[model samples]
Target chain A: MDEKDGCGQDGQSTPGVNIMASMEGRGPSCLNVDKDALAGHEKPGFKLCSYVDSFSETHAGRIPIVKSGLGKEDLFSTVYVRWGIRRHDYKVVPGLYGIGHPDRASEVLVTANFKLTFDHLRRALPHISAWILVLDTKGINVWCAAGKGTFSTRELVKRIEACSLEKIVDHKRVIVPQLGATGVSAADVKKQSGFRVVYGPIRAKDIPAFLKNNRTADKPMRQVTFTLYERFVLTPVELKNALKPAFIAALVLFVVSGVGPGGFSFSGAWERGLLAVLALVTGIFSGGFVTPVLLPYIPFREFAAKGIIAGSVFAILLMVAISSAINGMAGFGALFLFSMAISSFLAMNFTGTTPFTSPSGVEKEMKRFIPVQVVALAVSSGLWIYSAF
Target chain B: MKNLRYLDNVSTLVLDDEKCVGCSLCTEVCPHAVFEMAQNRALIVDLNACMECGACVTNCPSGAISVSPGVG
Candidate 1:
């Protein structure tokens, strides 16, 4: 349910007009709409809307007129999804959507149907009038969808024909996000469909300036950059993804640490097991969180190497802090190897998140370092068991 | 991007001059500014910077560009 921040405009008596419309497949995709919006209904003063003010009857049947201003519900859901919760299911129906009083000459912007991406696009179009053509990316964002081929030339052509785009817009151009260039071939789309695909700015926030400058994006708009805040925002999702695997590894370590010369001891498991868990947590934190934040500063082109550097530094510091508690030299060596291997592996996984890492580069790095990581893991496990006995 | 460079000399991207009709779509779509227009023909200006996103390969009408695309 959305807050009463102009969402209840025109004093509409219907309790959940917009929610009902989307539920019946008249509006854009909202897979998670029923869970929250349906629960909010039947309560007094509760207005549940999917940012749709009304549907405009157009050549493309019932194009939903989305509100340019994002409500509190929209903001809340965005934060929730950022932590990787319901991320796969968070999307809207792919179709034609209108904002403001768009005419035949208005520019048509193309984007994926991922709810967060859709929200960003709509929020950026406050005072502007435009038509949004949402492509079915299966809940994936523009960059990822494009890379995966869901936001392909095929899909673009299909959507244009299916929505009767030629009849709705007088112009021959449709502006697609620059990152979408990976999947969408402009020339192919122009050949297949009459609409000429114009590559827009990389970010949705630059839409106003891009339109003002005659639909041509400058160098900065076309290029991708990973700033501090951008790197920071991605860490939470990385940590969240590492959570389950880290827990399982910790459980395995605890059980393995219980094996000794005399018998399996719960006291030894509680002691050495906790030490192993600590080492694993240190590895995850260093690789997943620290490595990403300090990516540019890390002294290696390979992400695995960068992660090893980060993990080694943290492991040394941790070892020094708990040197008195450590059983012996073997224990210290085991912790160092264990943390470095885990960190390096996690850091290698981060290549997919970065914009500039080529698949070939990643494959090369993986082949070079995976063997080392495997050996380190094996050696560390042996040392930990030997130290336990 | 200059500071955040990836692995050196690893990209499989190659441009075929004979196939090129030179529409300049590659220059427009490449996020790394890898392509440049010279005498109505697109040339690779910074090959190392190229992340092999295949924006050029797919968008190139003449089949001038080719790269086996995949996320790193």
Candidate 2:
């Protein structure tokens, strides 16, 4: 299961943690490695950690992390090592990095100029000697860099010039990942730099094998796999983001209800309020996290709509139980309204992830669904107000 | 063959034949099959269908393609 598909590199957690926590059920979203603290190592030893080849901390940005002490120990091994949690952290300038002496004529691989992108690529190639010339895509992934134009021809040429690739590699050829096909020109590189660009497999792991098989990627290697593991990692970020608003709303519901004398009673309001908190959290989680994981098998592909349906069902069950158990005021009307509100929140966040969704699709969804959500919330609020009286 | 055109103002997804050296460089880099060779020349076949993913422009050997949007 290649881990590249987990919502790319967006970390969980948005902001206002305290407010969201008071409500219960906040959004999902962390970092870093101290060598002595790791499980496998103690004494002064090398740790497997990704270094961000380049990034800016001036704004909030992620540094891909790779822990220490994980590669093969054999002196002549050309194998890649795996250890700790391979985090997309560690920032540095995009270029060839030599943890040890890189034999000048070994292999020259191409990757995104982004610090995290470069970090991940190099970290995977641990224990191997190679020259990595990162294209300047201004901190973007390979697929996105191709789309955005930053990872296109000029930059590849520029990076090649900057790295002095011609001087470094004796062979007049460079191996590029297939994902960069959307931007790199093979023949043009050959003409200008006298280095024919050879596309390797879509993944870095396959690079060693691709080279072993004489610099060629099979068609299967060219295809991107959207596997289960890829989808699973993304679930956390979606859930993490939703947790904030969901919890805040629940807590406000709890604290506000307790303000009145009879409503705030420990035995009376406490249990009821707690139930509501649970319901809200469940609704949000169902919509954001659970719904997405079950996206393909969960009946619908329209992410937001699927999220809403899932959230709505969770909310209904929750509200119904609360109403029946506590003999509370939320009858059919309030239940309908509030359930829809939770559903809408989940639906809204689906856009943060999910491929195949275009800008137009998002606009259409917002147009049709946002109104319904606002109306439902308003109706729920009105019903709550009416019930209180 | 798809009739491709570059939206130069918006992105670096175009090919200037004047600078193009008749090398099949752009065609090789574009994963989406956006570029095609016509009479030993490179052309953008499906201009409207282009997602503006900067493949052709980046690998253009003659510095013919440019994805000029954000200031470098």
Candidate 3:
């Protein structure tokens, strides 16, 4: 029997078998199927198959039956992406992928090529059979990719044509993540490709609930919230980025602190340099880690203001802990200003990561506070150098 | 967007109702639900919720919506 029209024991079309047959070039309407293929094996509810072809130089066109659970490589890639190692380049090739055992009637969900995004979408629906249409966003997450226009109408149309989604799926609907809405114009997608775009929930975890409710997203699912947990999770990468600059600044301070009135003294320099380094580290933590976690509770909407408050608290504690080591008022003032400036700058940088801050708001805040921070840092550095002499 | 309002009165999003053809494209593209349709015209329901991603403006075929890109 032709697998496309084949039915299961319940008299329903065998979606799993049909999809597998199509992949293996056994389906009546199969296209782009390579001659080099492996044998297919059947399980209780689904079948497994593989094929290899060269569609494009970049993609070797090795289509493997996508399994439900993640493999060891997926786990390692998730961790690496979280740690921001090769994060921008970590992506799966964008194309049509069968998640469970989707047939023509099954839902087609769109996502970015960013591996984390693809993994999250697949993991969310372990039981349900579906089709995942990944767009080429150059390994960026949905929200950022949408903003950059990579997860766009043009790419979506291009991918749809390349994957021949029109021929595979019986439906003319594509469900896109709510975050990708910024880049994809549903009307334009409809105009360009004959498919209707249905925006799904803001979070991948809500996909089950969304589909359960007849693909209708509730207000909560549509709403985007950046809670403490959300902010805390993003801090790892922020902290990592801050460490490089923090180390370089500390090294410079160590050498500069050694230039005393009677020439360089290693012992005296080590003590002062250690104190300065501690202050810098404290500043980085306050701005990069503390500010984000306590964002909602922070007094002001402006990130720099929040950082200033956080930085002041840390600086005060440091001063009280090392009051006896201070040689003069200049040293104390310099340390305080330096800590505050560093914290404020780092906090301001976080505006880019947050969902709340707008491009205009960031610009306004930067225009108002960056000059002040620059002046403070310059004065602090001059004071520190003068105190060393 | 409840309990997640950003800065007050700072959004650069501007909607020209006169030019709006009431296609409702802005309502569909905004992730934050910043726009709503009333009487077949788009209205900025929650201006503070706008992150200025420019989705609405970009998708607005009638040239009714415009926002300063970097002002968000």
Best by lDDT: 1
By DockQ, the candidates rank as 1, 3, 2
List, residue by residue over A15-103, the lDDT tens digit for candidate 1.
33233334356434343443343442346885445676555677766676776756557877989898999989998889898887787
Clashes of 2: 56
Measured as a fraction from 0 to 1, the native contacts recovered by model 3 come to 0.58
- For candidate 2, lDDT tens digit of each residue in A90-207? 2346665442234546777788865445545654564556666767667667776776667666677777777666666567777778777666667666666677778777777677
By DockQ, who's the top model here? Answer: 1
Candidate fnat values, all: 0.82, 0.21, 0.58
Better of 1 and 2 by DockQ: 1
Q: Candidate 1: RMSD over Cα atoms?
A: 6.4
Worst 10 residues of 2 chain A by lDDT: A75-84
* Chain A TM-score of each candidate structure, as shown: 0.87, 0.64, 0.82
- For every model shown, the clashing-pair count is 3, 56, 6
Give model 3 RMSD, 1 decimal: 8.7
Question: DockQ values for all predictions?
Answer: 0.70, 0.15, 0.59
**Model 2 DockQ, alpha carbons vs. true complex:** 0.15
lDDT of prediction 1 = 0.85
Q: List the residue pairs that clash in candidate 1.
A: A28-A93, A29-A92, A29-A93
Docking class of 2: incorrect
Candidate 1 runs further than 4 Å off: A5-49, B69-72
Chain B TM-score by candidate, in order shown: 0.90, 0.65, 0.89
Model 2 ranges with Cα > 4 A deviation: A1-89, A98-104, A113-128, A135-140, A145-154, A181-196, A243-276, A320-344, B1-72
